[model samples]
Target chain A: MRSNTFKTLLLGAVFLGAGAVAASAGTLDDVKAKGFVQCGVNGAGLAGFGAPDDAGNWKGLDVDACRAVAAAVFGDPSKVKYTGLSAKERFTALQSKEIDMLARNSTNTMSRDTQLGITFTGVNYYDGQGFMVKKALGVSSAKDLNGASVCVQSGTTTELNLADYFKSNGMTFNAVVFEKQEEADAAYDAGRCDAYTTDASGLYSIRLKMTNPDDSIVLPEIISKEPLGPAVRQGDDQWESIVRWSHYAMLIAEEFGVTQANVDEMKSSENPEVQRLLGVGEGVDFGTPIGLTKDWAYNIIKGVGNYGESFERNVGEGSPLKIARGLNALWTKGGLQYAPPIR
Target chain B: MTLRDKTADETPRSWVRAVLYDATIRGWVFQGLVLLALILFAVWVVHNTAANLRAANIPFGFDFLNMRAGFDISQKPIDYTLDSSHAQAFKVGLLNTIIVSVLGIILATIIGFVVGISRLSRNWLLARAATVYIETLRNVPLLLQLLFWYKAVLSVLPGPRQGYVLPFSANLSNRGLTMPRPIPGEGFEIVMWSVPVAVALAWAIARWAKNRQAATGQSFPVFRASLGIVVGLPVVLFVVLGAPLSFEIPELKGFNFAGGMVVHPELIAMLLGISLYTATFIAETVRAGILAVSTGQSEAAFSLGLRPRQTMRLIVVPQAMRVIIPPLTSQYLNLTKNSSLALAIGYPDLVAVFAGSTLNITGHAIEVIAITMAVYLALSLITAALMNWFNARVALVER
Candidate 1:
């Protein structure tokens, strides 16, 4: 079974390799013809990130990003089919055209951006590698975990960062790796290791699944920068622009205070930037250039809401994860999330 | 004219007739055509793969093995770190696979033989229990059994601080089973050296005993003497060398046991799962083999004044072994291959380390997976070769 599964995956990769080089030229047309945008997402439940609910609906920041693209393309947020993939399968799924866009909580690394034949549209969630330890361990900082055993998901940036951080600090530690997030969580919960390391946002998400959530505490140190986002196959500039602008539209919507409820009311505002954003007296037909309707941004805002609203609803104070906005806040609010002017 | 000319004249047959009616020509033509088709198919797959890899910008080379793995593996048989080369990580994974499959093969064979005999036993409850074991375990999938053992059984064990103590100063917990590690001290080499010498001496004694029995019609207790010498020699060497082996007992540490031999729960769970699962099939093979032996042979031996145990061992077993061997060889190979399932439970087997985590990190999926498949093929071939040799040795000698 193992060999057969591996052979099938290898064969899929081979067939994808040939098709990817040809590069699906009319990806936007293909999505339209299919009547739904196939979006890749994290199959495992990472709370506030992409995860399925009891009713099998995908909900989170990344899911909202996929929905935003759907709204821009079809003018309906529900016009999407989500393909749940692991970190290892995400890129291949995108390259193979098994998925139109990948909105999984995947980091936008340089190698992935250039080498994997895919382009990350924009940073959906800025995260960093961090450690979550038992409170009784009394380890407040990552530096204190000198000889500790760390439970980590293999095949992730978190594993590499954990190794680098410990080596640079001259600490020898043991790493207990698991293939999946749930396995790692089970190991950590069963006390197989001293600490569990992943993205800080992931730590909070995982903590909610723990038997004793209050007994765990995330360490203060952030070891590595992880700007995770949605990605699409490269070489399709039209589709890339649409996916890229879907995120930019959300950010711009947030900048203009275009809440989903008031987006229609704000359509008649006197503000030039807001008017231009809504495609109402625009200097350039931004929507036409990106191959979408004039009210594409407005449609996105109405369907999936702005960046701040999605963040609040998914990972912020409005959700159970309750993660602070931190670096994900708008530039005016002293954060790194800055979108270009709509004009 | 056709029959007369074919026999009398040395004329070449027509291409169509030769290919259609000629046995030698027809077989070669068919084989050649099939080979050509196979080659064409292989070429197509390769061309597609190469083009795809080039398009994906993922270089199709094995140079990635030289790069650092940048990941941690828990069960390190040899010294390995995150800084180790991908090649080294592969070696660690291969070693772990060998360790589990080898241990699993030995344990499964023992269990299989015992259970197989019990199934044929006259004792009603024992036979029923053996039958139940064979039926239940063989029917379920191996992967589910591995998960049941790892998650349902091993994962439910208490943590390190509240570990379950076992006999012989061992401890069991979610972390693993920690036992005493025998560290070889000064003069330990002498005891190792004495083992081969003891075996040689035992062989000579056994040969001499067989000769004495043939000559005097009185058998010597050669087995007892050989056993004593083989075991006693190692003990005498150890004592003379001032008992040069110290036990490194596992002590409870911050989060786990420290300074001892730790059999990872992953390994234990995988070993148990694979061995138990394979043993069921092996038991059926043994039972069928034993049943194949004619009862008349056993009765004949008993009529010759041989005891029931002797009749079974000397008459029935030798005949039954021939039937049992070929299928048993396949079961052993299956167990070795199934050990790759350890990847699912995070046991860091060859597939997990190489095709899985290493491939994910390096993005050299094709090369890593190819290597992993090749390794399993090689492992299976080697096992088959060994088992075939054993089968040959145990087969009845013909004049």
Candidate 2:
């Protein structure tokens, strides 16, 4: 009788374990079954990062990241729906499976990776917190911002960095915070703040959209490191790899000097690495390892180009933001972007 | 109202049938089943929530409150710094919420009463003006109104460099209303203590006068005497202590003011939004309440030779208060909840600082939201309890 009871208990435990496994399915399958990728992008209107343009097209570096992932997964960048999320709502949206991945220029902080039920795929944009002030204010350095009222967006790393920078330097300042980036911009334009602070890249974005772009200038002080990147919900290695490699594919294409226009012709390149990345003659199918088609990297390049191309069109010199590819250039250049070999 | 009533003969046909088929017993059984189902549903919810959290690998616990809130609140109500723990931030948020809600309530009540009475004025212009004010303020959404006020404040005022100097050396600018900081000298505490002591003395005098009036059928000038004690003692102490206070004028140092007390524009916009929008509802409530009291009460008071103002004070308002207190409690609760819209304009209320900023920092959405909801719920309950006690006091004795 005792042995029979123990066997029944063991059988019940096995059924429970099987039930748990069936519930937490992979996100890639969900995206494929749904026929599109739901990506969380910036809703707080940080323009060149992730905001919809006047023509209703979502055009930004972060938006391109989502499109690249969708292109890799479904072989079409347009097979993606964007959910614009604010800084405060992004992680909860990701954790609750409201989106496939968050590409809203979120910083990959240690606490967020280990604690927030989400993991950063890779750094898509390297940023640091900086200040923007009116040129009329005559503030040359951030050090002169003592006793200043600085407008900043809430629920961001900028506020903490501002406080730390001020406190450690033995200065006092007032922070006028707003929930949305546009509101902070409006306040700064309206002269409610002496300086506006955000990620340095975002400062360029903010300056471009200000009422008088010529009146304001971004200050030359980077207060804190903010490795802005795309992130996915934790505990799904298959989905994580698919998203992580989508970014690496962009960098590798950039490293090989592969432009979107030349991708079709370069499919026949003699270089083994280029052939491996574009899946032409490398003999090995790179996409199968990450559960995609053989032309996964090729689709991303064709859809959103390499990282440099996307950056130039959205926020770099090709666009109005005019930001230089300082830290975001390929590893062959004197920049930080590096990707492992595809083969 | 007992379970068994007289002249009911059907249940006694059989002891078994009676126990099984009696109305009270059947009611109890069905209610018990409903209670069981509710309990089971609650248990299922808790079990599923835990299971889902475990499956997603999201930690669901209150331990996050002990973590450092590495974010900075724009308006710190207490001594919260960037290095403070999330628990301390929660306290700062709670205190800020209380400060705004209390100030908004007091301001809204004063305006509501004035407008409510104005809407019923004998003069046509006053009543029509009050009506227009109510219609305009109530029709606009509170969020839009907040944005309007905040944007207006930012646009209307000049920057700190070109701020308008108001009376008493206060500076009015887009940043805020900056006034001189009051530095307390060594003996300012003695003068401060005298004010509260005078209030206690006034309370004692009022009690003694009330008893004398009850025994001798004579009323005393309690209001004037208590007002004197409260104000006069403070003034006398100030003179005796040689008024040990100094004012430090704010100077344009770097980019803004230094050595000043600043009232942030975000708080101003939030206070204005809650007060103006809530006052209209309160005005309507007061108007309805005054109309609720029967005209016969006023007629009876006039029949007793009371004048119009005396009749209103003695009969109409007292009767109207019973109707007003309940809805007024609702408006108070609404005001407290509406203050959470402070998040839109970036006032560091409990929701903005704790649930919005700290939640973003710690990524503990569940715990942060739960704590914020509990704080609002507790605030509402406390307000309701106080209003209920007042409601009971003014409730009809019905002797």
Candidate 3:
């Protein structure tokens, strides 16, 4: 009687464990079956990256990348779902499969990728650490900052960079740390710190928040390199490839003169490279190997435009940020943005 | 033939008795199996972590602790730099947490005791004011209070160029509250050591006077004598050492204060938020503890010709402490844990430095998080152990 009872309990436990394994596997397969993509983004903070409109519609450089991926897979840019996450919760949200891809303005670092068990596909924005001080301080350069108090956001690469910069210069300075960017900005504005330090792009966003934007000037010095990119979970090669190719497609489109407005017109061109990119004639099998539609690159360019177009529209000369495309420009244009050939 | 049959029957009875007698051994074997299973599970987890780390091409070691932290901390209690190792950075973070918690606890206790006493006061306005204070602070989230203090209060202060002058050569500005810093000379060390010695002697004298009164039923002016010794001895040492301390007053220079010790506004806001929020809960605990003692006890003491203050001191406080101590210890632990919120305001607490920046730089999330959690757990356990010893001393003794 005892042996029979033990056998029954063992069978029940085995069945429950198998059920759990099957359920998890089923979820992954379900995601693959869905043609569209779900990408997480930061909502309505920094301009040129992620910001919301008066109607609450999100748009930015990162948001465009998510749309590009959605267009590549489902042939519909609107198929993407944007999950807005805070800094503290972003990693856990991605790890738990709440979002298939995180294309937010997340910094690409060894710890975030390897330690957090996430993979950064490629760099989207090349940034550097810089400081913004009040113009009245009469400080033209970061080297002048000796024993100056700096306001910085906590839990970011900027904090470490700040320490390294000050110590390397053998200068002693007080740091006023804040968890949120807004709080740090507020502190900086109130003169809690003599200067505010963060990513160059972040310094621009913060400067815009100042009541008198002209009063604060970002110093000429760039402290450390910050390569921002989209990240996906490990062990998901299919998803990673899709995200990577979408970004490359934009770069290739720009090299080939494909803008959102002119993509349809470019379809009739006789050029061999354009023919292959639009999936018009021969070598149309590139998208098939990646499980995408034949006109994947076409949909991407039409939906989100080329890389240069996206940059100019969001954060470049046309936007409030007015960020110059210095290192972010194409390699042909003496910039670092080069992609491997699609074919 | 009958004797042979009885011997065979005894064999069956012996087998049944053996089974019943071995039950204790069986129970012990079951418990041992459970312990072994737990140990094996832990080992398996460690093995998996090691394997995963190897596969990811990451090193599994604490060598990173000696590497430069490279991150700036805002309110380090000790001298620290980015050139310092990860270990030194952690020490700086831990010290900042300790500084905030210790200061918060002292302030909270004083506020709590006064508010608690006022809650039971005969005056209506005093009781109402205390009630309002407790209700307003305790209801709000601690994080919001921290934000309000940092943003709404401290951040609104004028810049150093337009510093607000307060009494006693103090200046309030967005930079921080700058006050006179006392510079200690060579002889100051000797005077400092003498003060503590005088305090110890006074404590010894107080104990001697109490024992004499208990034995001979005679009173001594212990309070007056102890106070005189503790204060007078410290003063005499300072004078004998030729008053080796001098004040370095802060002076405005260019756009900032040049001299004196400046307390950063982040530290001030964190302390204010922590103390005010914790004090409300502590006040409630104090009130409940005092109420736990029966009114009859106080009335009985009064009938014996003891004054109200004397009755409260000898009877009520001692009994009330029995109820108050356990909850007060938990409040202290909560305050310590809540110090992690210092990260929110960039105060460079343990979480902000070690678990945060170091974890990012090293990419060893699992190890860093495990270490941080272990540190907090150890702190909580130590506090609990200390409180338990105190509680045992004050526990009711029954025959």
Candidate 4:
């Protein structure tokens, strides 16, 4: 009688464990069944980062990141919908499953990763706190901003960084803060502040919106490290791997000198690395474990272009933003991007 | 059936019928049913919120209040740093909200009373002008007014490079209005303490003068005497203490002012928006209250040899106040609640700092929002209680 009851309890425990596994295993299948991936993008039109075009089609580096993930999963970059979100609403929207993933320009931090029920895939952009001042101000360095009034957007880490930078340097400054990024931009344009502070990428974005873009100059100092990346809800490891590898596929494609124009030609190359990345090797099915097509990385490169191509097209020298690849280069090229071998 | 002998064998109504027809029992039954429904609904909401939070793995707790608020509040009314706890940040926000609302209330009352009386003035242009002001101000949305003030009006001002210099060595720029801040010297504290004592002495002397007038039919210049004691005593004390005060004038050092008090543009914009918007409603209340008082009281005072000012002061004002206080108290509450709009302009009010930035940072929405609502509710109740007390003091005491 005692043995029988113990067996029954063991059976109950097994069922509960299976139920927990089943609950988290469906996010990938759910996205596929829904026929489109829902991606959260910045709503306030950060120029080269995430903004909708005149035809209402989303465009930018962040938007392209979402499209690349969709391409990897569904073999079609267009199988994605964009939801514009503000800084305050992005994480909650992700946690609530209101969106499948967030590709907005969000900085990955320790607390957010562990506490907010979200996982950072990888750094899509290496950003840092920087200041932009009117060229006429003749302030060459951030340290020269002593006693200057700076306009900043409230509810962001940039505010804390600004305070720390100034305080550590033994200088005092004033912050003229606003709720919206556009408000801060407009205030800066109207000369309500001596400098406007945000991420370096954001400084470039705002400069494009300025009345006289040439009249302003971004300062040289980077006060804080902001590793902006994509994030997804933290429960399903399958979904996280899919998002993480989608970005890695692009990075590996860039390292192999593959572009959208040459991906078809590279498919026939004898290089083992290229063949494996394109999923054309014996007993090679890297995508099936992640519940994606075998040619997932190939589809991403073909449909969304490689990482270097996306960067140049959206925010780098090929685009109007003209931002150089400072620290975003590959590990082989003296930068931080290093992806694991596809084999 | 109509007379008396038709129902000799009639029995009492059934218990169900009797109870249904009983007003007191019916009332209690319905009330209990409603109370049960409300309780169930509240429980369902709390349960659903907890379930959702658990499913999302978002921890629901107030431990976030102890976390470091890694942000800077530019307009903090108290000492705060980036290392400050979220609880201290909340206190700073609450203090700012109180300061702006109290200042807005005082300014709105003065403007409202002036505009209200002018609307009832005998001069045609003055009345019409006041009427136009009320219509325009009341009809416009307060948010739009705030945006207009912050963006269009203040932002368009010249930069600090060409700050508009004003008299008394003050400066006005898009940053703010910068002026001299007064610093109290050695004996200024003593002089400050004397003013309150002078006010109390003045009150006692006024009471004595009133009693003397009533008992001996002798007139005394009570108003002048009280005014002299209140104003003159402070001045004499200051002079006797060798005028222990100094002014620190603001100077244009770098990008903005230094060495003085700075009234930020956000504060000015919110103050202007809230006061101007609320004054129109208060003006209408005042006008209606004054109009509700019968004109006969005014004529009766005049016939009793009272001047126009005396009739207004002694007879009309007291009755008008009884009608005004209730709605006026609500107006004060509305103004306080409306000050939350300071968030839109980054005024660092309670809602902006605590409910907004803190909630966003910590991700504990339910707790933060509940605390904010409770604070506003408590403030409204306290204001209502105080106003009710003042209302009772002015109420008619009939023999």
Please write out the lDDT profile of model 4 over residues A1-343, one tens digit for every residue. 1121233233223322322232254678889899999999987888777899889888888888899889998999999999887675677667766689998888888878887778999999999999999999889999999998888876677877888899899888887766668777887888878899999999988998899999999999999999999999887889999999999999999999988999999988799889989988777679998888889999999998998899898898988889988898888988888899998
Task: Report the C-alpha displacement of residue A211, candidate 1, in angstroms.
Answer: 2.4
Instruction: Give stretches of model 2 more than 4 Å off.
Output: A1-24, B1-14, B22-29, B183-197, B204-217, B244-249
What pairs collide in candidate 1? A17-B52, A18-B52
Q: Compared with the real two-chain complex, what DockQ does model 3 have?
A: 0.26
Which stretches of candidate 1 lie above 4 Å from their native place? A1-21, B1-4, B7-21, B152-156, B165-169, B207-218, B397-399
lDDT of each: 0.85, 0.84, 0.79, 0.84
Q: Each prediction's DockQ?
A: 0.51, 0.32, 0.26, 0.24
**Lowest-scoring 10 consecutive residues by lDDT in candidate 4 chain A?**
A1-10
Q: Could you give the DockQ of candidate 4?
A: 0.24
* Residue B150 displacement (Å), model 2: 0.8
Candidate 2 recovers a fraction of native contacts equal to 0.53
True contacts kept of each: 0.43, 0.53, 0.32, 0.36
**Each prediction's TM-score versus the true structure:** 0.94, 0.92, 0.88, 0.89
Q: Which one wins by TM-score: 1 or 3?
A: 1
Model 1 lDDT tens row, A1-343: 2643464376466564454356747799999998999998987778788988779888999999889999998999999999877766677678667889999889888877876678998898899999999998888889988768898887788888898999999987778777678878987887778899999999999998999999999999999999999999887889998988899888888998889999989988998888877887745457988788888988999999999999999999999989888999999998889888876
Best by DockQ: 1
Where does the lowest 10-residue lDDT sum fall in candidate 1 chain B? B1-10
